[model samples]
Target: MKRPNIVWISTHDINPDLGCYSGVWPGAEYAVTPHLDRLADDGARFDAAFASAPVCAPARSAIMTGCFPTAIGTMHMRTKAVPPPEVRLLPEYFRAAGYYTTNNVFTDFQVEIPPTVFDDCSPDAHWRNRPDADQPFFAAFHGMATHESQLYLGEEAFAAATAHVPAGARHDPAAAPVPPYYPDTAVFRDAIARYADLIAEMDHWVGGILAELEEDGLAEDTIVVFWSDHGRGMPRAKRWACEAGLREPLIVRWPGRIAPGTVVTDLVHTMDLAPTMLAAAGLPMPSHMHGVPLFDAEGTLAQAPNQYTYAGRDRMDEAEDTSRTVRDPRFRYIRNYHPDRSAMQHTQYPDHLATWSELRRLHSEEAKELAQGLRPDLLTPLQRSLVAASRPAEELYDLAADPHETRNLAGDPGHAADLARLRQTLQTWQGRYGDLGLRPEAEILEGWRPGGRAHTTAPPAVVRSPEGLAADCPTLGSSIAWTTDPPAEEQREPSPLERTAGIPVADGRRWHLYTGPVRADASAAWFRAFRLGFEPSPEVAVNIAQGVDDAQ
Candidate 1:
């Protein structure tokens, strides 16, 4: 059987608000995503897809590695944690299986992806750039047009954009429906409308990519999978484990394989996509991957419906908290390890939005109202609890009865048995995954630090050896690499400096990889060093002026 080419198009902070999910959201009729709607019409639409982690880096890490972020020590947001060397990433497996893998620009994965994972991984990386026309390819395109920051363009710009809104594409903020927890203020409504506009923009980009596939005549042979990194970029959505945060829109278009307009209601996690793609390519799933393949070789659903899907939240931006959630079809359970912390923790990113400011202002006013011997009905009990100094350790909600998850049933005697069952399930999952959430934040940070500070490779000290210039990092076991040109900054675009031949030292090797010292005739050289789980060292230049004996 031939392996189908795969194109994974992922977007940021979007949930299943598309027309095909149900109906166009009120006031978001202008979010006419005809292309995505058409794709859903022609392929499989997963209604219960969720992200394993709420934040970008951790969720992306889970998706790329097919393992829970916690299992790989990548659960914390933006904290660089290197997985054990033995763990292989999804693209690496696909590449090993003869697939030309490329990641178009953004790789916000929490861990460093070794160079071997991709054939090309630059801003211009694409399946169209593959050297061989017949080679099976795996490409990922990440769209950021719908990111939360785009909604922060200020009121004047938003009004101008809304006024000029393309013909029938004008979303009225006054008619937008706000979340139950949020006050129906102009700021909140405008934010929702702007978000819808961005989603429409993101859809346009998706259409262009699909058109390219058709133009290349690779549409039929390629499997197109579209999804978002997590949920909508709102206060309670992006970093929380509510359905708004964890649930995502997933559409798979595998022409001639998956029947048109098929809807799968089975629970699926984002991490599962990695293993599913591997299975589609006829490769075995590695044992290290925690995700299960959803489809068999025949392009039919092979797995039984999952009883529950899990999601987690930890250390988003400057806020530090640990929360775990378990969601079944009917019930959603949340366990907050840091119950003393308010749900409205000071996260710098979300605080930039007008809606966030409105929420804070409303909370303050509600507090004042209560002090004056009167309670304002503007805030719901759940909303009040969110801004409180402490929170319930455990919360249980029945989605069938209260879809908004406003009521907590954890303490209800009638739901005690249901709560216990879900609680046990969450605990078992935590144990199975070796959840690092239970560990103290300081301990986790200390583990990533070397010599009582954050682990950063120091530049190798260049000394005038008897032979010539010798470079070595005294920090023991640091991997050293040196070249005539400087290395690229870590996590940025690959520099032309990378094209030059360089010496590399293997991890755990005490000595530098270069066996012999540089000769006097050599030009000035640049050197750097890095260890797994740590930041790379600053570039150090060794000038071989005049002769080796006179080198500074």
Candidate 2:
């Protein structure tokens, strides 16, 4: 049997707010997501999928490697720690197995984007761009229309984000559902309505992509996967490691291999994606990956499915804090390491949102009401917890009883066993994973960058071989990317993490992932190499013209 081709569509900072998940989430019914609904109808929709982290960089890093972010020292956003030599990326294994891998442009994985992970890592990459029609390909597409910044980055950003939604199709602000964490205000309702528009735009884009696939007559030969990096980009949902933040949409369409309309309620983590895809493609899962495979030819998951999903939060943008959470199907337990710190800390990015400003305004009003000994119903019980000066050391919520996490059951003696079990689970996970977030940031940085300067990967050597030319790097675990074509005057796009990252990200469009040998007479050949988590080597030019050779 032939291995199925894989195509992953990842959306940023979104939740399962599609029309198909009907009663799962309250506001899901309001979304006009015909394309996503059709996808679920054609395949399986996971009812209990969870992200490894509440934020994008950490969660995406975990998904890419199949290892927990904490285990590999990538738990913090824009983490500067380098991975141990043995912790190889998952896509390299795919490429080794003769699969063409491509990433459609988003590579903010906290670590440097390794040079050999994908055959294509630019905005123009797609499954259709594969060289051979028969080769199995793993393609990834990214959508950022629903990102948190889009909602507040001026009216122009909002207009571009929601361009697909017609004026008549816009949702009514009054009809939007309100989460218990926020006070019922017009500002929030309006934001939610606009959020629906963003989802509509995403759905339209997906439709176009699917249409292209069908037009190519490759729909049946491919396995389609659609998922979000995390939950809704709102105050308590996006940054907090709560149920609202961790829960995300997951849909898979594998013809003949998976039954249509299968709704799975297993407690599966998003990290499982790496192992699952590798396993489905008949490849061995690496020993370092912490995720479990959720696929087999029999169309059933492994006998021992996950009973719980775990997540943590560390250094979100400007906020410095530590917290961890573990959840069974019906219960969630959160341990706030920084118990003295307020739940709402000063973060310059999210503070600009209208909803954030409005929530602060109402929180201040409630504080005044409390000082006057006047008990007012302005803030709900759960909403008050978000703006509290300090957080409880431990929190336990029976999600079945209080889905909104309105009440804390940690102090209750009746559920002692549940609390003890979850607490121990969280403890065991932390001990086993060896969370790097516990260490001081300065210490980690010093270890990665000795003398305040990064250690660069050794430049690759271009040698004339029987085949023509082969480039090899001397550094251990380093990957080399080279091109035989002459260099073009392409402008390099800058990355915010470029200067600080352990490995400088290489963003070359024409370079190919170096394998054995290439047929090149050494003329017009250019080479660049990078190790797992260190600075990329400077580009090397070989066999250039006379004037350029003198400069070299």
Candidate 3:
């Protein structure tokens, strides 16, 4: 069998809101996503795809490494945590199989990519840049135009910008449907419309890449995958583990293999993409990955569909909370570790959205207005209740009956058996994964950075080898470098008379980037090591008393 090329195009902060998945919600007939719709038409669209984490970095980490964010200690947002040295990233496995792998411009991966992982990882990185035209390639292109930060523009400015939206795709703010939890004000409605507009913009970029593949005559031999990092960036979404936060739009186009217009309802996680790609490349799946391949070699759904999909959320920006969710086709169960923290806690990112601001204002004034026998514009009592209510320790929702997750079924007497089953499932998963969320935040941070300080790597140790002095770093995965001179020591003279005495120093200009053993002409040398996101190792001097050759 011939190896197929892989192109993964991932977007940010989008759910299954495209016209193909189901028309855009709340009366908007369709979102402008012709290119994405075409991709769905040309291949399979997964209606039950979900992300393991609600936020970007952690979720991307899960997708790239095929491991749960909690298991890998990357569930916290924007936290730097690398997988153990033994683990290999998705692209690294492809590179080892003689495929050219590239990640274009966006790798907000929680873990650092080892030096050998990619052929190129810059803005210009692309499959076309592969040294051999016939070589199989795996490339990831990230589109960020639809990110939630884009929606932070104030309502007036956002509305003004919508004028540039394609005339055929434009949506009116007045007619836009607001989620039940949000106040139905023009500000909130316009924000939702603007998000749809951003999705359209993301589709434009996807079209460009698809066109490139077709023009290059590689579309037939390539497997193209499109998905989002997580759900829309809004209140009760993004950082929350509800369906609106974890569910994603997943479409895979594998020409001549996957049947066109095929729709898969089997539960699939974002992490499954990596394993699926490895399977397509005919590489053995590593044992460390938590995800299973979604499709068999013959392009059919793999046997024994997953019984439950899981998602987790922890420490999103300034707001700190820990929650885990397990969902089956019909039911979704959430366990909040910190139920005391209100679901509406002031998270930095969501608080800036126009809809969030409007909701807060309405909720605070609703009581006063009702006392005066007045009603706010389109603000329902239920919506205000959502804003004021605190999260429960356990939340159970019958997704089949209430897709919005508005009703809490945990307290319902009739669903006791269902709740117990899902709770046991979540507990078993947590135990098996050694979920760090069970630990205190301070403890987790301490584990990441020993002694509660930025990890300071030890200076490279120098030893004699056949060639010369070989430098080895004590900290695994850190880059090593050697300088003839130790960093300039701070001169603190006890007395002015001692200032004239010369401090022995080697030539600083002789610094060299360390790859392996290098023949050193000098008997003594200085070495240092550093890794991204960690403190630099202190410079140390090594004395070769027996000379480099004799020491060997």
Predicted model with the maximum TM-score: 2
Q: Residue by residue across 1-552, what tens digits does model 1's lDDT show?
A: 999999999999988878778642222244668889999999999988999988788898889888888777788777667565446557766776778888876776765544446666766789988878999999999877777887888667655533424756756788676777667788888888888887777777899999999999999999999999898888778888777788888999998889999988888998899889988888888777888888866688855547789988988877889999998888999999889998778777787677778778888898788899896766677666656788889999997788667788999999999999999999999888788877886677676674567567677777777787787776553555555543444444444323211112113211123434656444766566655455677866777774334323
Q: Which one wins by lDDT: 2 or 3?
A: 2
lDDT of 2 by residue, 281-395 (tens): 8888887789999876445656436888999988887889889999999999999999998777878878877888887888889879989998856777777778777899999
lDDT digits (tens) for residues 442-537 of candidate 3:
787777677867777766767777887787886875666565554555634323212111111222233455667866666667777766446667
Best candidate, lDDT-wise? 2
lDDT of 1: 0.77
- Distance from true location, Cα of 278 in model 1, Å: 0.3
- What lDDT score is found at residue 40 in candidate 2? 97
Off by over 4 Å in 3: 23-29, 154-165, 370-378, 452-552
> What TM-score, computed on C-alpha atoms, does each candidate reach?
0.82, 0.91, 0.82
Off by over 4 Å in 1: 23-31, 155-165, 452-552
- For each predicted model, how many residue pairs clash, with residues at least 3 apart or on different chains? 0, 1, 0
Error of 2 at 77 (Å): 2.4
Order of the predicted models by lDDT, top scorer first: 2, 3, 1
